[model samples]
Target: MLDNTKRQDIKVILQQVWGYEDFRYPQAEIINCLLNKQDTLVIMPTGGGKSLCFQLPALLQPGLTIVVSPLVALMENQVQQLQQKKIAAGLIHSQQAKSDRKLIISNLTQLKLLYVAPETLLTPPIWEKLLQPDLMINNLIIDEAHCIVQWGTTFRSSYTRLGVIRDALHKHKQNKITIAAFTATADTLTQQTIIKTLRLKKQFKKFVINPYRSNLQLKVKTVWTAKGRKKATLKFIQQQHNKSGLIYVRSRKASELLAKWLREQKLNTVAYHGGIINSKRRAIEQDWLTGKLPFVICTCAFGMGIDKSDCRWILHYHTPELLPEYLQEIGRSGRDNKPAIALALISEPTGWLDNEDKQRSQFFTNQLAKQSKQAKKVFEILPSQGNILDIIKEIPDSELALGILQNLDLIQWQDIFNYQKKSSNKNINSVSTSQQTKQMQQFLQTKQCRWQYILSAFSFIKEAKDFKCSKCDRCSLEKPSRIISNK
Candidate 1:
């Protein structure tokens, strides 16, 4: 608990800085926990004020607060907002010029907050600078921490190595550093992965706000063909009369094709995905934010850390491979507490008419299996114990493969750069890749309220047990007609 004087100080800063008179439920407590030097994990809904929980405390404390984020867009979005408020904040990523990063590093002690992606943070230039003797650091925050669990084993391998930041940085510093992780969607297994991967202390406090949002209505529609799916999505968007939202697809090709088709229909939108350059991606995001663009046809790359309220709808051109992803995508809607709709389009039961969803799911499954085999082969070529940095010089993707091995409990890092293999016969990819697909399919076919199914899938059992939402498609008296018609 915060003392009244400390509490009042927080309120004054809040009012003066962000113009919020008081903190939302548990936001104050989260800030207090950080102030008291307690390690914390916060699982709050999107738009539920999670950023403020750490940002406010960073302002209240003394040394620099290093925020480890997963994406450059997220870091830039946050750092730009902090700059607009005239706060002493900066971000470092691969996209920035070397000279700019050097300037930021030169003034590290002056910044109240520094946002960085894990991969960039672990690189030599940034890592060496942070290890300097004069630098004074305080809190280390992992924003969008769920990415550690979701992407660590594959492309974003640096996430699994984040636990090293605390121990390695603390060795040269006198003051103890605390860590706080914040995310919107993490189930029990995901929560454990985060705690274990980040090596959160056993005493760390976890604050979970129920993820149920009453203002967001959920719906799923079955389409007989890919053409019908696009038609249905177009119909929904046309009905919105240019309201702000997003159309989520699974691939860059899909996003581009959909955006082109929508434009042919005279809908004003653009495609957004990782394949595009950073400058164009940022411009598209800016256009959407300013309401110049009504919506964007994008992959998962577009949503994290985007601050857009009053987004009236979210349409899934293809069902996601996992439930957590679906939850995170839909979370972008109804952010301002206004009624918003999240509708997912899936193929008919047998997928005989349109196998897009089935094909996409199978592609990912095969990819995961291939990666598992690659990791095992990489593990075989490794010495009994050695440095990862050295191995990476000789072996391509050794870091990613090692990360997958570590995730599977076949290897352990002795320090930031060193690892020792553990004896194990457990098959790589033993963790069920299809379980998520199965769960997502169940969500589409479930007869219960959509919100209840989501809550249950996310391990919010108590919330799901008696959950009854009057707004979801399952609960609403009205029903949507089938997407295909006999002509």
Candidate 2:
């Protein structure tokens, strides 16, 4: 029941302001949902027109659309772009000047949109204003929704206060003020967390477009050392030119070290981790957008709202612990329909005291990485490479141990390298534990359909009108494969 005339009205506004016509597949559905004044959750892939889904809905709605975000630099960049289009927009994060924010608040009722960080959403006056419909109040939006999960390191404690944001807005409007939460990476668990934290109803509809990118080829290489991984990364970049990419690592030190190393080899690149100041990060991001830099080697902190659509290489120099995060990072590339590749260069756990233990997993415990400290040392005892029995003898309880290391990137599986029955019927250890280990290893070495494996895990498939990648290793080796229905 989406009205086509409203879309044309939006297209005319878009052309006059932002210059665009027509909506991408899910955009109209999102717009129609927002129009219905419902509380909605949008699970979509990166570059699937997520910003437009919220932007156009904000424009068509009667009052202002207040967006709650966590990325500060992203807010400034997006607000500036909208302002250039002559759209009435404002940003009210903590970093803004006093007078500027005052002006924005004064015109809140009349402005089209306002981008505020979670910090601002907690202010007393901000909440007081929201309690009145006379102020700019039509819809409430929260971006980067996965951060709300209870087990997220990226989690913002203030996000738990959003139940107040909605409560105040609803107190005034005779109608239920519309609410929509959007994210490029969130599983069913995280999705449920979003609704619970925001305190919405089971009746709230869900729009989950499965996590699948057709034009991407997934590959994992088991290197023996950090030195080996670096060599592989440089060689791949040399083979592909005029193509953009992302390289992720566990430590800020690693991010800096790799950028310096890549530059030493004459590749134009920069390091981007959360440790940098906001202004510097903004400057670096601006340069990347304008083509001044070729690659960004970053920690997990980068790429929240970046709109780079032409990146072709997404490299994980180390194996990422969480599969969903890995999915999000690699999905950043090949967004423009060109062939892209995700390479995870990895090896077994080294008997060394690396700083990885301090960087991640402080707040969250992934399924693959939940075990006791004694069990984890088994990773070192198993040696860099070993068979299942070899692993079990060292740890004695590898089911718990191996899962921890796999989630922590201390060990990674590269295909079902080999399997042999020791006794006449020892059987291939077809128990659930072995099956899980086998599957995890398979993900490390899958060469079938590029997008099917990941989506299948989450019960998602690809669409017919999606971008296709004929040059990917899988597509090159086989006929086109049909991913299941994402809807």
C-alpha lDDT score of every prediction, in listed order:
0.87, 0.67
Error of 1 at 314 (Å): 0.3
Query: Using alpha carbons, what is the TM-score of model 2?
Result: 0.76
Quote the positional error of residue 349 for candidate 2 in Å: 6.7
TM-score of 1: 0.96
For residues 233-304, what per-residue lDDT tens digits would candidate 1 score against the true structure? 989998899899999999999999999998999888899999999999899999999999999999999988
Model 2, 272-334: lDDT tens per residue? 988897789888888877778777898777776777888888888865655666777887888
Candidate topping lDDT: 1
CA-only RMSD, every prediction = 4.6, 12.8
Clash count, candidate 2: 3
> Residue 4 in candidate 2 has what lDDT?
82
Candidate 2 regions exceeding 4 Å error are 1-8, 150-155, 172-175, 349-442, 445-450, 461-487
What ranges in model 1 sit over 4 Å off?
478-487
